[model samples]
Target: MKIHMTRILTLMLAVFLVIPAFASAAPTTKGSAADLRSALGNLLGEHAILAINTMQKGYDGKADFADAAGALNANTDELSQAIASVYGDEAGKSFNTIWSSHIGYFVDYVKATGAKDNVAKQKAVDNLEIYRLAQAKFFATANPNLNEQELAEGLKMHINELLKAFNSYVAKDYASVYTTEREAYAHMLMTGDALADGIVKQFPTMFTGDIMNNPASDLRQTLGQILGEHASAAVFAMQKGIDGAPDFDQAAAVLTMNTNDLSNAIASIYGADAGKAFNPLWSSHIGYFVDYVKATATKDNTAKQKAVANLEKYRLAQAKFFATANPNLSEQQLADGLKMHINELLKAFDSYVAKDYKTAYTAEREAYAHMFMTGDALSEGIVKQFPAKFETTTPTVPTSPQVSTVTMQLGSKTIHVNNNKMMMDVAPFIKNGSTFIPVRFLAEGIGAKVKYDKTTNTTWIMAGDDKLAFWIGQDTMQLNGMNKKVGATVFVKDGRTEVPLRFITELLGWNVAWGKDKATIIMTKAMAPASAAAHNMATDMTNMSAGHMSH
Candidate 1:
């Protein structure tokens, strides 16, 4: 097995690095009790992830606190990042250092235990208590405005909850493990809320301006409601699939209602028709997840294959829904999003099946978090296309663009034009000079700024002033702005375009160099001040004052 003590040790380091310690709550209008609670929950969740990751990694070894500690470290890092987003760089740095060390003590204990050194283990555990006290005092001093005694109590609660959860995991009481995990998660949320409450009481205005202060307006609430519904439906569907229950229809109806709530919220942010399309698409996903879970329970190979097949069907339907809901979406764009979503679910399910609870929960956390992205994507698309509705609203930001094509100049080399979209994905067939790209892919991926003229049998690449056109089966290109023509063939290969890569790059004003030995393509260009440069250089330190305390 890939699982081993060494792997567990590695994971322990990760947990210590990622998870942050709780801190005293300062007054922030944006901070809330819920915020505090979530922080605490995340702290516990981080421990669970590492513990589980450790157990999975060291399946053959004695599962212990070392695994838990590694996960805690990783969670601290995650918390530090989230804090950096709120507070400034210094705060995150401070948190990473402080929270990370506490988990180190746990590792010492684990190593001691492995060596059968009770005295050393006892010393390590005692050291943990001292470290806990120092941490509590650190928070108290760090945030002078917070009630030190109250903060200490909260911190103790968080540590105890986490310790208990870790213990259950060590005992291999899986049900208790999960229950404790959830409890720890909940406790963190509570602690976070307490901290946030303190802040809200201290500084009402700054935090109040953000929707985070309003429980009714909170996006997390919407996500929780929708996800809860979806999860319930999924669970029921799986049970029905397993028992071959006739009452499955009833459960599905309830699930639909839950999905309806999700879609309705989406529609409110998007539109009615978009919401309607999302309902079935969303429901089908739940059905597929349920089918997969059922197959796993029965250890049914054929059933699992059928479930995977069903997943494909669900993907197409989901893709179609996205296309319909987001009219501006191209087929490639839809396919990319669908593939990511499908992969995430599969990864989470695989982790769950393997009893690798750490990865499973991590995947769950990611999946839950991603739903917000889904909401944001749909919202942004609606607002961008139909500016009349969904204007002037704050939604979660989308992921940064991974693919970009820019123009550059190198003296006489005066490089211009690059279809970077095509260049990036030629891994399958670079042996042949011509690269094949599906026709529908152009509309979805490469950027939606492209147009396909049906009557003219030409495809237009909308970049800047230069609009390059290519027709089928001919090695000729036409500039839409200018009547200038260049030699390049757009031949049909397996229902895709086999166009000239150099021709596309030159059109985009970029120098493209290909390395045959390394199978690498490099594009160089000057940085544009109009985009990423103009943005504030300050590390996101919006809520820097709050991090790392017990609850």
Candidate 2:
């Protein structure tokens, strides 16, 4: 086809640069803030690389464009999820709409380039300009501290740099293309840093220490960089494995180096003993993933299953090691979370084997995003267990609820709670006339104790003398040692344990008021002695320790 390289490069540049702007602004702890930065950097970096690769492939009339495009869409899904982690599902959906539109515009630009249609190319550029303004406005509104004028200026610069890169590529300037690509990748890191800094400053309580000012922030960022890069490299390796690409070995080697970096970081925090234990367990999982890919290529279903079984064992061992290393880390919860990670990677690999590019890319994006959570959990645990090592400072106590009158809607998984202005990973919804909410969000909101028993798939809530226990996937519950039937079944959704709001509130002697017109459920606790409430809140905060806080 020998398509117009310049136009394709321009479209790629425009699409990749705008993506990171939307990828910013998620709720995170000190460790997670670092993790978030790393995740965004890797995601945006990969997008840039993939966009360039796709453009090159299109220029040469290669078949890899579909795979690249699928991977790009996967990146979009992940970016949306990151936003949703801080914002609500509605906001995430809204972001996807705007973000995807720009990608579509770039695709149109590419088509025009291929067809040599100058008019269509100009139209696409016009659309992109409009998109740039809309995106800048969206983020500025979301985070007031982010200067709209500054954001606009920064975006303009991104566009200019991308155009320069594209024009250079068109002129067969390989050196300039490589130089601009590096600049573009590095620029997104700055974008991620700015976005993360703004969000953390806006919600100081949600993150660990001041990301902008703390030394520990550097540690978190380093960890995030290493771990996030590992995920991106691993996914790229897996894709190369399936394609039998010549660069597969190089990509695989890079992935291994990333793992070594992660291990070195662990050793720095926990000493060589812990690192020795961590290296084998961490590296083994990567090996297993590679094995899965190989088996799939050979049509050896039995070998694939064996690889999965090995991963399950790895998850348990890894979870236990972290939990034993840091008391604040829950073994069962870690395992549960780790299981999701393992499955996501396996699914991505399997889908790739099946030649389902869309499904493969979707799984790849999910697997990549899951690593940030893993990084958050591990870093948080390490920071908590060895605070002095991180040069961490104690957080000041707040006198009031981070937010007043937090609201949740029925049949929606959007939770508006916490000081960070981030959405709960799981949303509250109505089931069979009773409202269901994430136990931790509601219980922790009112200074109640919430614990999960992974062995029995049950959750325990203690608010004063009244204790309630519910099993996942069951309608039966225990109220103060007595068996009781609930209107709605307790279940686990989106990695959270959910329970009926009415039953739990009633047991705790709290009022559950419903706003039918608004389809909202408001839980109000009766006024207690000020001293008592403060004590309870302090206790709850203490229970969270440093690592246990939501990332």
Candidate 3:
């Protein structure tokens, strides 16, 4: 298969180079901007997600590790194909070799973690650093528009982000692991866009106008990203949900966050009321899917049918909701699209339940890729509806914050994190004389990592080197993994877990304060602490070994 791929890449390069002016050979460019950007973003983002997922599976010695890794290799080949198409056969060859080497290094890191071999892990890291330079240099040498230094820095960040997520996973810093992993995924989109830009610049006649400079295209690709993420998160959540997997809650949390992003985007474009109404409409479908999975687990056909009926209702309602918001979007077309989504998800889930993993994997990819089409359609309608907001305007990239602060008013459904308004399904309320609300997002805001284990109904928080864990309905919290007496027990409300806001925040290295009115709580993360080293220390190291350890 590898040799066959090589020959195919060589052929692609020959065709690209041999045709200098193939007016008879070049493709048309009507929506080339959106096409190229979405294509690159899709493949590159998948690479990040698959790589990290493969690494975790490898580390865990999961039964599906082989399947995950195989999927990752398939992605690598596709990426190389993209490179080959742009940079010709030789660059593609070099990219595959270097890229494969880095993935091998990551594999080695995971293996070393299993063996508790710190030296081997460091060796992997050192090899990765060398691969980083080679990768950047290769790209720079291939495309004059791409800078060697800047490319190297981006490569370095990529390496650091992937490693940091891996190490955080090892240290059980689940919140930051997801956060860093997501940042890593987002970082790859930037890389893809840069790569796409360089290619379009070098071969303008082939690719047409600047895809990199269009805001409308940006909206399209951004929507593709989050929408694809929603598909992925939903699939994984279903898989975990059926298995009662340890990370099931985390998977669900990911789905919820994706919903928040989609809803927020809706709010930004349509109106707050539309976004607000959209949440339950969106969440209802998720719940129905959950029901489907549960029914399938018990072989309850009637329950499964009922779940399907609920989803059908959701599909029609959601379609109308969008059509009502903008005339450019047709209710029938949207209903058709929603039907496709539902079928794809059900197929993926059903395949997995039957242990047909190969089909399940393919179906999952199909579902995910379909969302890009959905995004393209939705973005087109939106851009058409509000040309003044999207077509001519450039969206600014958000900069990293200097300080992160969050405020919550007692008995309110809204919270402000870094001055950004976030609405929760459940409102903050007094329980046992303590203000109670969800802290997963809040703790994450203050540079803390949060993890929820579904099996035990426990939530864990990590900051710098400090750790705290508590089980639902338990009065004792574990400080640094040891049981400590805490008078408060977290309780689940409205299908969301609520914790004592002040206690949980303080435990995760945040300073808590009450406003003069005594109804508002403010949480701020202050001072400097060692973040999970992006360079990453040996995660599996134990006992007394100072030969290669760093704090």
Name the best candidate (by TM-score).
Answer: 3
Model 2 has a clash total of: 2
Model 2 C-alpha lDDT per residue in residues 1-551, reported as the tens digit of each score: 42221123223322332333222222233454454455565566556545554554454454546876777776677677666666667877888888777777767766777788999989988987888778778778888656554455445545554555555655666556544544454445445656766676566555543344333444454455455456655766787687786556755776665566566566655676887789888999999989988987888999989998999999999899888888989999999988987787777766766667666666665565566556656766666666654453233454333323345776665655423244577877654333567877766665567888899888887766555677898755664443443434578888898876644543333333446464676544323343355344433322222221001
Relative to the true structure, how large is the alpha-carbon lDDT of every model?
0.45, 0.60, 0.68
Off by over 4 Å in 3: 1-30, 207-209, 393-551
Candidate structures ordered by lDDT, highest first: 3, 2, 1
Model 1, span 360-475: residue lDDT tens: 54554454444434433443444345443212122233334223333322111122224432322212232122322333333223232457677787776544333456677554
Location of the lowest summed lDDT over 10 successive residues in candidate 3: 542-551
Off by over 4 Å in 2: 1-189, 199-209, 214-225, 272-281, 300-324, 330-337, 391-551
Candidates 1 and 3, the one with greater TM-score: 3
Q: 118, model 3: CA deviation in Å?
A: 1.4
Clashes of 3: 0
For residues 54-165, write the lDDT of model 3, one tens digit per residue: 8987888876678777777877877777677766677777889989999999999999999999999999999998998899888878887666655665677678878888
Q: Candidate 2: global Cα-lDDT? A: 0.60
Task: Locate the minimum summed-lDDT window of 10 residues in model 2.
Answer: 542-551
